[model samples]
Target: MLGVVRTLTALDRLLDVLPVLADDMRVETRFAVAEGSAFARNLADELHRCQAQVVTWDEATGKDFDLAISPSSNGPLHELEVPVVTLPHGAGHHKLRATETGVAQEVSGLSRDQLMHEGRVVPAVVGLSHPDQLAELRRNCPEAVPRAALIGDPCFARLQVSLPMREQYRESLGTGRRTLVLLASTWGRDSLFGRRGDLARELVATLPADYQVALVLHPNIWNKYDGLQIDSWTRSARRGGLILVPRLRKWQAALIAADVVVSDHGSLALYAAALGKPLLLGAFGHDEVVPGSPMELLGERARRLQPGDLRAQIDAARPVPGHRQLAELTFQDRPYQRLRTLIYQRLELPEPPWPAHPEPVDPFTP
Candidate 1:
């Protein structure tokens, strides 16, 4: 059994590669959650669909797994004795070291300088978030070049909606016909938007009058900003000829349906880019901002949203042909194939043919 320890965003990518492995191999997978939080429950629910077992740290000791797969940094799981593969969740600097603990692990997705600085002290594997990321990683961790595996952003491989749901989602959310989907989440303290209230108002004021705006709030924001009157906000936007739909829907469905998406630095923009939807990324607080990210790999398909520039950006937003093509080329390449092979090989299983028409798992149902 492969033990996966990570967040839902990380699991989103794992699910994409795991099924291909599970279908052809003899391995039974399970999740080892750190705590029984909402994120854990969501992860457990998704894993259950694959018929994988789910366990918590309190229930099962960390030593039980044959191999531990962490889609995020495994630095937190250093105490475990199992051989671990760490797939960093994002593109940035990472410090890899033994850290006063005895755990042999490799950290993927770091610049070359970062790897050079830390590789001397710890076992590390470097993978790029973009072509540049790989270049930087090699420059920093020269030794890691041989062992480095190009496992792309796991988030790129999330399950999308089925054809039926796609149509239903379109009808329910007004996806087609010059529509803009606003993916809202709670901005961190250091975010440029400062407060959720300020961002919401800015969105209301800035969006074009002719466009239909669907505000899909993240689950976390639903609880935190419950006091804000969504109906009133929608009414104000409606007066400007913008249709504001406040009811939430699955992120995948929204991404697929949207003509363009305006979101802060979150997984939604990534999903949009994967689907070839035009994306305008909003820069949040200080820490959330990365001047250039894998998102830029989308080229004209995406742009960083600037203050007082929303109208012009929205006007220029158009679905680019190479959006999904580049994404597949860069992140969904052979390294992902290797990860799939590793999962199957570990399970001692044969490979399954790729499903021509895999049904999208319903987010509401699971």
Candidate 2:
């Protein structure tokens, strides 16, 4: 209902972008739909494309099920009984009250009073990355932290499957002998660098001859603010010998191939951390979109350097000695199996086997 702001905050939910889990669980969808809204229209189109059964809540009554899911802080949270579950639309360390989707007043954004009510009421919650996450949940929105086992993030679990080989990705994206640096922008205007698409130019101008930068943009960045400038920069950079990664599938592939990832508190930093590569913090912790995701802590994990020090930092960044595992802490994997198991456990239905492989992903397509 907050339109673009909400759309940018939780596009995956807006598009109904779900992962292909093991079983064909019938997904009956309901929308607090705002007619004529561009985001609403996009959501309807995406849900149709996903072939989900769209139904109003009234139409969905009496369906035999173990649980109903909101996939966000809101979604008919009230008017339900025990065992109704929520899968927060976004992840990390922010309070539900702080998100664009968490109004706590409207059905889209549940009011604080209602949230605490639900917190004491709902049986379970899904998609928490770490055990410590719950402390904040209970501390900040005690009324909303559900009373059940916190399931690991299904999205992160699915993302944990092995990625495409670096060599294969290198050949496809043509990084050749140079080290690959992915210059990512979550919100170019508000990132620590405080400029739109200009960091790529700065990096390109200063990086050593052996390194090549790849430009990958968040959908919000290229879509809402800097499309023309991004395109122009990408083209000019490509001519000057940088690689311009394709959107969606190719972008995911580029993530796998990146030797170092640079971002200003974007999800890419989190994803790159999941990939177990060295990360370069740009925005530090400037949270223009949503403050305090688990990702905002990446500045602690990565090397913080000025724009001029990027190349040198990359050179100096080696694994942090022994026993210091990186990135594995980011995602709790097994999301496909977890959801199916939860359905079986809660609904007394049979669980499906895990997918046999790590299927290809398109970061922008959904």
Candidate 3:
């Protein structure tokens, strides 16, 4: 199997599926980090940690594979000669990106241009996490609909299994008897960092000793600007007791540890809501969000972060009333089993005798 990883986020999502094929002695999975994405950093090192064999993009293209799988649709996905499976790297597809002309915008991955290359569909199987997305695919890229497969999200499956480990995660983060406030931000100008870069610093400085503050930023921020830039940007926050979650991992542990979560329209926010945590929309980029999407609905149901005493707001926060609805929309039952079935069918192999299960996520690394 060929794993075409484009960015850190993509790598994170791909990790959820790779374990299913890991234990099979008959299979070998080689990873290749597709070039051109600014957020593609430490990929080789991360892959090495997994003990996965790393191949150059050139070599990946030169060799033949039984099947190729990628968590992202971006980059050179069409170059692979074998059957390719493409999946959403986040909580479904809820964001929009500008067209090449910069005049019009469309759903990021569902657009025909993104799903096709040279007048042909790119992925042999386009994985969809929800049933609603299939309708969206029909509306956006009708030609790709026949190829679309309703594969449940592997990341959410892992998170669900990790729910019982929340206390262990909190202990690892050293939140001893204190309320942990997790701030999550996506990338780009409209994200929390872009809107309020000093929010973490101010929260750490202002929140009493009974509360601990931690910031989890999208990997794009760290790789696009480099760690030194982020350190410079959040030096005071770090000094004032801010915990910046590691870029490559442990963000999920932070979510599991959080007593309350402040976020924009990122997938972390959606995941937090699904976990039934008290959620506050610190900053939401409405223009970039898809209308009537699950995220847009989250924006409407979630409490807005009002100005003035942040402590008072935190104290008064309640779990989003729509959280159960969000959870229902975000995941499907028995995802790992479904994923294993999908992959084996694509590989033309018989099903394994043992039941498929998602490994519990690792605890907080910091």
Per-residue lDDT tens digits of candidate 2, residues 1-366? Answer: 011112323545333224433335544334332232223334444445545455444433334434555555443444444355555454443332333443231222233443445345442543455565566556545555555345555544434443645566676666778898887765444553355456676677778787878887665454454446756756666666676654323466677777887766666666666656776666644433323444544545566656556678777764222212334444445555555566557655554554523345443311
Greater lDDT among 1 and 2 belongs to 2
Off by over 4 Å in 3: 98-104
lDDT of 3 by residue, 199-290 (tens): 99989989999999999999888878878899998999898888989887689889888999999989999888888899999899988888
How many clashes (backbone N, Cα, C below 3 Å) per candidate?
Answer: 10, 12, 0
| Total colliding residue pairs, candidate 1 | 10
Ranking by lDDT: 3, 2, 1
Report every candidate's CA lDDT.
0.49, 0.51, 0.87
Q: Assess the local accuracy of residue 72 in candidate 2 as a C-alpha lDDT between 0 and 100.
A: 52
Worst 10 residues of 2 by lDDT: 1-10
Distance from true location, Cα of 64 in model 3, Å: 2.9
Pairs with backbone N, CA or C atoms under 3 Å apart (clashes), candidate 3: none
Q: What is the TM-score of each predicted model, taking all chains together?
A: 0.63, 0.70, 0.96
Task: Identify the candidate with maximal lDDT.
Answer: 3
lDDT of 2 at 98: 34
